[model samples]
Target: MSASAAGPDWGIFEGRTLSLLHPASMLGMAALSVSTALLGFQWRRQRTIGGEINELKAQLPNLNGAKTVSEALAAAQSAEMVDTSYV
Candidate 1:
């Protein structure tokens, strides 16, 4: 059969679909996907860092001074400030 006589072949794209064709929409979708991926990575990193921090805190010798969570946070903040200032 001649090429012109044959009908257009849609079989190639049968199992696939184009959800976004417009330039703006495609760019927006790409940006959203990248943002979501970065957010997921950051969340995972924060979770890992938080676990490490908790583990380290557990390993430290307990001071009988701070009983409340607020007091502990304040002490940690103060220690961080002094550490940073010395650096």
Candidate 2:
């Protein structure tokens, strides 16, 4: 029998003849859609975080690696020495 003549019904597998309807299939589809939305949200958040990091890096001073290391070492050397008598 044709689908329309039977009755008006809204279902995933209403008109399809070869389709097999299972409760688990509906759950699986729901899970797939939820996961897809979550993944898209996560991707967008990560991209925003990455852009902010890049912007901060650009705004900060670009120090030479060797010069910064030497400055740190000099500062450390000028600081008071820690006593190891207790150890």
lDDT per residue (tens digit) for residues 1-87 in model 1: 577526546554332343233666889999999999999999999879988999999998665589877788889888767555657
Q: How many backbone clashes does candidate 1 have?
A: 0
**Reference-based TM-score of each model:** 0.37, 0.40
Query: What's the C-alpha lDDT at position 55 in model 2?
Result: 89
Candidate 2, residues 1-87, lDDT tens digits: the string is 576647646554465632555656888999999999999999999879988998897996644443675776666676546677955
Which residue runs does candidate 1 get wrong by more than 4 Å? Answer: 1-21, 58-87
Candidate 2 pairs with clashing backbones: none
Model 2 residue 69 CA deviation in Å: 5.4
